[model samples]
Target: MKSAILAVVLAMPPQAILAEDVPTTVAHPRPVISEIVTADPARARRFPGVIEGENVATLGFLTGGRLASVPVEAGDQVMQGDTLATLDQVTLQQDLASARAALETVQAKATLAAQQFARAETLRARGVASDAMLDNARANRDAIAAKVKNARASLTRAEDAAQYSTLTAPTEGIVLSVLAEPGATVSAGSAVIKLAAPTGREAVIDVPEAFAALLPPDAVFSLRRDKNDTAATTARLSVIEPVAETSLGTRRLRLALDNPPKDYRIGSLVEASYATVSAPLMTLPRVAIAIAEGPNGPGVWRIEGADRRAHFIAVTLGNTIGDRVVIRDGIAVGDEIVTRGAHALTENQNVGDRLE
Candidate 1:
């Protein structure tokens, strides 16, 4: 019975291997690690701009004359209908006076002709004056009446000329420049002053034609004094120049500011940026992107928190801005990504933390 038992035991499968007796190998590698930086998908990029008035007006005289007075200068604010400048009224006044005298003379002649016609009519009725005499008196009266009407029209024109000698502001605005000095002779309709409306302040920026074409139709914007300034004001894309500037290869964009800061003034330099974010995205260092694809798609070598091993995680990529790329998916915030030497890493490989 003992021999039979021994034979059964010897034929039995070798005793089960002990786990403690087995040896395992572990790998440790030092790799660059970058903490995920959470931010708005649409990052603001600044472009230079200038603050200016939306409506810029060039004011001048309706008629030619020497400028006797110019009451406003650059930076002076004026209301609508305020006198801006005036021409020497001496010539206009003299012309008006002469017209008035001419009118008076024509009126006297008409009065005398009317009296003579009345006398002629009575004499003809009494059979003393001939029909020829009545006819001549009537002709003289009609001729004088026509002269009086012409004289009255001349007087009215003279009065208008005198009134036009003074130039007034068409609207409330600030004077931007004084093109003509006092006592300077200017031609009719020549620009004398440059005025800008108080309202309608806008930020003027030059955008490359290519860049402008890429912008969305409803893209929003904001303005700031500088890149470091935290304060921002809303802005609307008001107008875009139909034609591009050949020399600069850029198009003019006018952005109307909303509730702008008090320091914003005409000619002030500003920075403008897009306010709308198309999508929420995660940003990662450009070096972290691997050329190879994973089972899902484009991926990164993500380090495991507990194991300190690199694992390939598929990700959807987006636009790259500078040295960073927009991550559309797969990686969560706070995930440690291999920024450098990611191309050399393999799936589930041990990694060392190196933060820079």
Candidate 2:
């Protein structure tokens, strides 16, 4: 019975069977599409940074001696004239006392010599003392007087040295580090502490020379605690180191923050974001591009009309930025291109959204 039914259907008109075998092709909706336009014209670059001071000063003692006491430590706040450290005062006091004692002895000898010279002068006037003896008395008195003058000058310097034995802060600031401790001997002019002025806070960043070359003198900056945080604030470019660091191939950039957060102190970690200036160019989604086996423009399958038919259009590509590539030519704004399944498309093929 089945063979008989099949034979009856095949005996029908040949035109009816041919028409039922071939189905008509229909234009379908596009799933993924991209419009040609200027995309992300400004390129933003980020660098890690830290808060720093413009005027950081390293302090040391003027007179070398064994440190007897250190009143301030790291992270301590200090004011002008505040004592930072003190050298052993016993040796200083003894030196001062010796200078004073020496001065007293010279003064006593000078007094005795003057009195002897006076007696000799009186005797010489009465013709009782020899001329040679009188001359010797005068020379001793003058020499002792010169000795007294020398002793007085030595005493003055001893007093000054005693004063310099105590190290004091020159200005109000926060101490960053203390290199010397009590009982340690340090030489004069050797750094004992590091201090930074609390006036201007700035961000220091090491940027690659390639990126630094494109940055303008007046480039703008924004600093944030982290990359994902939106609580960022603005900063201004203050200086760029002229010489590149040969070892790192980078240059240091100093940016001033007019209104930084209260918690943003010296050495605070931050991220600096800034934009690079470049000429505007046309671009398309990276997914819309596909490699073809030809020499000329690796054509893109462009979608057109309400029918959503795919057409292969050749184009010239430039640089690639993030998820998009620059379209130098052969495409204009408002043109839709197939972003998904471009590899499976052909010229004038009916393409549409695939139902999941």
Candidate 3:
């Protein structure tokens, strides 16, 4: 009976062997993707930029002195001739007092000299004084007269110096900065305050010299706050710097804002958009194109054949407008182009199974 049981077990297949021989279905999940068709359209070019005032002036004292008091602070609105600060006028006052005293002394001396000259002229008329004595008296009077004039000039100059102790605003604008504080000693012409006229704000942007030829004279531009999604302020191109800013590898372009915001301050960052060119061209989302090695060189992916399989298509790229790029050639309107999931696609790949 044992021998018969052994023979039956050999005739039947082992359980492990049967399990390994079983067949099963392997399922692959298709990737989800979104796509758009190539269409000919015009798009604008958005460039990063910054806001700036048309007129920015640094306020400072004409004479060097200790800053006695600063009445205005940063962000203070000021008008032309408004007192911004005052310097210690102790020395200036003393100089003016001395000048006045000197003028008085010179005037008194001039009066005495005039009386002596008259006396000398009378003596000469009576033949008691010689011509030389009369001439001496007249010369002394003239010398004293010149001294009085010099003293008066000195007084005027001293008074003018005293007036310089007060720092005044140059234009109607807001104070952007206050460099000197009370008791701070500043040198002559040292910047003590920064003024900016927001009413004359301009949008300044830097563009590469290579692309400068594409820009037009008096082109319209749009400017908005950096990282902002709000509507931009319209401006017109007014200046193109003759020399390129080598440090930035770009040329400066200035635009005059039509109506600036009341709260728009100077030195605020902004983004600028310039319409370089407008032409009928096929544009597609940046993601729709996939770079791959082809028989010639770099190529993009496109749906080909009724099966809509991904195929490598060679194309020449043009300028990029926002998130879309212009395909110079190789793509046409109504052409179904993959926008997403194109990075993983290869030639002959079945896009029908691709997920959107």
Of the candidates shown, which would achieve the greatest TM-score relative to the real structure?
Answer: 2
Q: What is the Cα-based TM-score of model 2? A: 0.54
RMSD of each: 12.8, 12.7, 13.1
lDDT of 2 at 134: 99
Runs with alpha carbons beyond 4 Å of true place in candidate 2:
1-45, 61-64, 79-81, 108-150, 186-190, 242-244, 276-356
Residue 125 lDDT, candidate 1, scale 0-100: 100
Residue-level lDDT tens digits of model 1 in 31-72 = 565565465433455689999988999988887777889988
TM-score of each: 0.51, 0.54, 0.53
lDDT of 2 by residue, 37-104 (tens): 54333336678999987788998888677788988887788999998888888977888899999999
Between candidates 1 and 2, name the one with more favorable lDDT. 1
Q: Sort every candidate by TM-score, greatest first.
A: 2, 3, 1
Could you give candidate 3's per-residue lDDT for residues 1-356 as a string of tens digits?
99999998888868867778997676443252645453342225566676676888988887777788988887788999999988888967887899999999999999999999999999999999999999999999999999999999989877876888998887799887898898888877998988887478887888776445445576777777755548667888899889988887788888888887755567677777764345444667777766665454434677777766777777778777668666777766666676778788766777665343
Better of 1 and 3 by TM-score: 3
What are the lDDT figures for the candidates, one per model? Answer: 0.82, 0.81, 0.76
